[model samples]
Target: MRKALALSLCAVLLGGCASNPADRDISGTWINQVAIDAAAKGGPLREALQAYGPNLEWDVNTKAAQARYTNGFENVEGKLLGEKPGAWAVDFYGSSATELKRDGKQLSQAASENEPEQVFDRAVIPVPEGAPIGASFERALYSAYMGGSWQVVSGNGEGNTVQFQADGQVTGLPGADRYALCLAGDCASMSGGNDSIWLQQGGQGNSWIFARKGKTLEIFQSVNTALADEMPSYTAGDRKWLLEKQ
Candidate 1:
């Protein structure tokens, strides 16, 4: 009888070890924060605002929560969690469908209902296949003014550069209001100086320093000649025409 009891106890223990299903319910309004990992490829936010549509709402409390229309189709809500800056997870939820886990273990049926659900999608934005990830603001300015085919000519000693095209075409290097100067050796010297420079084609250039933190680039400059008058001046309303990375 002792041996029979031992066998029965082993069977019960094995039965208890079997895996159970998840029981967590994620149907409530969860507040989280979100950082801008990647800017949207299109001008959807601006278009939405201009069209008088529902603007994308980000959680004010959490630094990793965002809600926006995905590809002009379904509205996607994303949540990211991690201590490090870049590491994050996203959850894509449809209007009526149940939330799904993207990269985490599911809970057992006996799990508490208050347990947080694992994020479903890892990436914040669904990038198209073969899309370039990031671009500098200066590079973006080049492409916007000189078309997508323009190439960087050279980086002058100051915070200026020239760009050109293949067919012996010369395009002006557009100026930036606020320039983040990655100075060589000592960036401290360049800091707090409000100087500006003149770009003249085939002529000596002049120097001027930046004054404010958020100054706008008024005109395109070239070391060879003053291209400010040649190039079109961008205005506040022209910000809508800025190029976006896909």
Candidate 2:
């Protein structure tokens, strides 16, 4: 009887294992409609998205993940860990782990312990791959080129200091604490192709445009802010402020 009981227990365990669902494969570009919708209603994130353009795309595969923002110039990569529980997790090295729960065609991420979950929908249309040279402008390249303390080299804000943080925060630049770079655009040209780095201080309708360079940062204050309505344009003459990485 004891031998028969052991056999029954082993069968039950095997049955439970067989009933478990297979690990899901989440590999595609995801657009954050939750953030976009929230921005349309008005908020700090909205203002930032407006200035930077709401084109944040998450591209992931079985092993790697990337957060492409503002025309894909500001790109951040994370490691794609296999599915855990019912969700797939992306580990951003030392920063954070983003767990995405898939439901049909949508993936949802909890905004916080209390806030409503943010939703990401798989993109039917993917972001363009950009120019042939685009591959050279990865996040690591830009981070190494721009990250750290900087001092105004020659232009308007000469002698002033600023910082380009690894986490996207900008320090010491007046009326701005965050930055986004736009290098390419979608087929519709709705979000990017501005070829400018946008900076937002706080509140709606307030922003700054800076031309990105190798070691120097150029600010174009004279450029008309009204251009935010259409394609933004700025000439070399508009750039009078500069900062050199220290």
**Residue by residue across 1-246, what tens digits does model 2's lDDT show?**
999999999999999886234335456666655444443332233243344333345566764444332224346567766777777776667866667667777766645443345566665432236522123222322354356678978664578788876445677766677775443443113322233555776643233455445556666653443365766444323565678766
Q: What is the C-alpha lDDT of each candidate?
A: 0.27, 0.53
Runs in model 2 with CA error above 4 Å? 1-142, 154-157, 186-194, 204-209, 222-237
Model 1 gets an lDDT of 0.27
* lDDT, candidate 1, 1-246, per-residue tens: 999999999999988885332222222222111111111122211222223221122221133343222211233455433222212233444323222221222211111243333222122333335432221221232233233322232233223333432122344344322222211112222222222222334443323322111112222221222255553221121111111111
Model 1: runs farther than 4 Å from truth? Answer: 21-236, 239-246
TM for every model, in the order presented, reads 0.19, 0.38
RMSD of candidate 1 to the truth, in angstroms, is 17.1
Cα RMSD for candidate 2? 15.1
lDDT of 2 at 13: 91
Error of 2 at 70 (Å): 11
